[model samples]
Target: MPGHLIRKPDPCIYSQFLLMQLNQPVTWDNPDVRILSGGVEQYTYDLTADTEYTVEITVHNSSRDKPADGTAVSIRWIEFGAGSQTRHAIADRVANVPIWPGTAIVTVPWRTPATPGHYCIEVELAHPNDGNPTNNLGWNNTQVHAAQSPVDRSIRIFNRYPRDCPPVDEGGGPYLDYRRAIYGWGALGAIGALLYAHVGHEGGMGHSYAVSVLAFYAIAAAAGLVFYRLHNERLRPRAAVARAATGGHADCHRVEVTVDSYEFDDATGKDFHPDTVFAGRTVVWPAHVDPPSFIFQPGEAFRDVTFHTDAPDDPGPPGHFNINVRQGGEPSGGVTLTITRGG
Candidate 1:
């Protein structure tokens, strides 16, 4: 330790890391529910007698299976969404589909009940009664929807504006360098005037002044170019926190906010867009709209997704906090948001 610490561990990261390493219950009762899949591994399932519930089953691209279980099935169930209305709101309305490993399974199209309902959905892995029917051999967890708003993004997506960057005055800035560029060389050409003045015994002094002006004029031109580049290079917004609201309108389904990494759940609480948005990375929702995972375009690089998660992670899986932005209809063309992390 010295008078000043240059690079210290981030309290936020350290705090979260400490949390992950701690042993805690990820499920309601025990370690029954856990996120073993890839991105956005949480969901909510709504059950209505006549309504259709669609559950998109994604496997952990890599093998995280145990031979003892042999095969893992992803079954959908409804419970409460963490602080849900009540435990009995969605009394045991399980779908009639069983998803086997290695395949994308979706529940048949069916309408949900006409009455209002709330249920926490989870994917549990069920295996042979090796004697424990209580053991959900599948991925059992509840996911949230996209309706919820995002939470604070101070240390996550927004960081302080860097110093050493040239001060950018929107309307006005120092222009002394500009005037000098076009005319600084004036002394080079102004020599004639100085020579004429010297013919009268003052030219020597005039010539000296002319050369000095010419030299600085050249220097100013180079300096001006450097300044312009720096200004243009400052594309990212200044370090500051800002928030805007958009919803209760006809076109509220399309919301795209550029963030480092946000949690995004679906509207049903069954499927949050992203159950987990690792700190320091950016995520964009409406993931389907973007297509092909990464949202890179012909000329730019970067993808931005909405953070979707407002569920319960009993053991504190950083459950999820998000900020919501309402994006209108489908984009006419694809878009790429370039987010800068640090200076």
Candidate 2:
């Protein structure tokens, strides 16, 4: 211990620096989509964010309606922002219908945003589907969410992952945690052995218990490595998990849902606004399909439509209400409802 001042730096230090940079996760998109009118055509995808991706859209006509041999069609792109401002849309393509039940794709280039976050890609059809080629076409939007990279927090040797999306099996039981720590200590233990060897050579104690010091260092080094890896690995899922859970996390709040039209009987229904997200900040429509069937109370928390299914049934059908949550220009988290019966 007295002559330790002349020791050299640990060779594993470089590993430590590399491990830090490898663990943060990049972003991804969800790509949820919808098309206008009733038809068999739909978009299918197994998506990823860190890779170059492509999208395909096919419009199939209702068996009942068929276009004369050929028709015209187009696809458009709209970017939906988090807060309650009008989403920006960029027209992408328009082409002649090649098949009766046709399929096409507008390649969404892999261009990362300047700011890091999730973004929804909305595609609207400007031309009609094959079934009703004469009918005007419309636009719809979908989300493309990102995934996070993994981290290396081992004490001795660092584990570096670029994105936050930790591998599903990253979690290990107690035995595994200890195994990693011991592994790291193994690295440091090497240095300890070198010191012990130097000291033993000068003292000529090669045949004594002084050599056991090497064993002690081995165990200590491993425990540190294992402990470090386990700690950082637990936190990588937070970013993407939050990204997938809720919507409109922007500063103001945004709720916008595209729709065909609203149906009402002439009472409280007359004032129903399909484009206006209830208090005006959430996107809650697009004529949301299979909107949860449920009842509502007058004073319950009104942000999530999913919560409506839990609401106490009202006195009558006239009072039924439903709509998407609005975030841009009105009440921050509350949602608008389309009342079906009890009013």
Candidate 3:
């Protein structure tokens, strides 16, 4: 005879079902925010100093069941960088969200800062019963510049950290040591030539052998000097100036600048289906910081860094160039310079 056994319900599963019924489900339906450039749909563009521009902030409600009425939207501008930024309030407004997915655009008149430089835009949305507040903010920190050959641009670097931070100089120290080693080798070659001449005279070596030995030394020194000069030319500093702020001492900081170009092909697909292939990636300038590194005082300090680029003479296929700046291996800022070639 077989005995029938009844299985008991798991207490953990029962408790989980009770908790799910008691707690309200969390939904991500907050307002989506975006900042549009003046008179254009573009979110990022260059702004003129002391000039007035009309910027638009668009807010959208994603939840179909929730209607956000009188949603408070605020817009602010800040200096373009990765670290601390001083925010300047642009404007604040209210918008009404319909029951269905709806959008509201708030226009704001912004006057650029007196000092000319790159800036970033930030937008925030506030609702009383918003489900998710994390996605209530949006930032636009990219800028585009157009220029011809011999493009020159200036950027301001600052040490926004509380303590003294040294700028990373990737090429300076090693390059300096390399030059010293080359010089030492040259000196050794000179001394060896003199010794060789004296030994040849004493050993009754012919002038032909002496000439050959001297030629070998000269050839080695010449090759070393040429290689050294070529390396120096490749790593020469374009232009970089550092000036300490008031009450701050001047310190050198290394600025690493990189220029990259990319072209897209519509016919080719990338990792994802239908995605355009990113082809023809040409590194215009490799990542190298001239002057190696710069120093910063104990407090906040500013430096003026400039870099240059030369456009191709042929104006080949249309592509865009990205100039990125990094400090301490962190992305400080960058700009996308677009180039369009006509058929």
Best by TM-score: 3
Please list the C-alpha lDDT of all candidates, in the order they appear. 0.30, 0.32, 0.51
TM of each candidate vs. truth: 0.24, 0.25, 0.44
Candidate 1 — worst ten consecutive residues by lDDT sum?
8-17
The RMSD (Cα, Å) of candidate 3 is 24.2
The 10 consecutive residues of candidate 2 with the worst lDDT sum are 150-159
Instruction: Give the per-residue lDDT digits (tens) of candidate 2, residues 1-343.
Output: 5434432211100111121123211111111233212332222212333433343444333232332233233333323221122344433554333332343333333332344433334333333222222223222222211211111110110111112323343446455656656655665675666676777553444544445555656667666765667665665466446645754132222333221222222112346553432222222222241322222222222222222222224444222122222223222111112223223
- For candidate 2, the TM-score is 0.25
lDDT of 3 by residue, 1-343 (tens): 3312322111000011121123311111111223345555543445678877777666666566656677887888877643325778999888776643356667887888889977767677787666545546555545444445555555455565536555434345555645654566555665666777676553434456556456546666667666666665555442122333323442323345555554322231234332234233565533222333455445555565554555454645534555444555444444445543333
CA displacement after TM-score superposition, residue 247 of candidate 1 (Å)? 44
Q: Which stretches of candidate 2 lie over 4 Å from their true place?
A: 1-52, 63-91, 98-102, 106-110, 128-323, 326-343
Q: Count the backbone clashes (under 3 Å) in each candidate.
A: 60, 84, 6
How well does candidate 3 match the true structure in TM-score terms? 0.44
Q: For residues 1-343, could you state the per-residue lDDT of candidate 1 as single tens digits? A: 6513332111000111122223211222112222222333223332344544544433221122222223244444433221111122222222222222222233322234456653333444333322223323222222233232232111111101111223444323446434543455343445645555556644444456556445545555666556654764453233211112222222322234321233211132333233342223334322222221222232222233333323232332233222222123221111112121211
Superior by lDDT: candidate 2 or candidate 3: 3
Pairs clashing within candidate 3: 169-292, 252-294, 252-295, 253-294, 254-293, 254-294
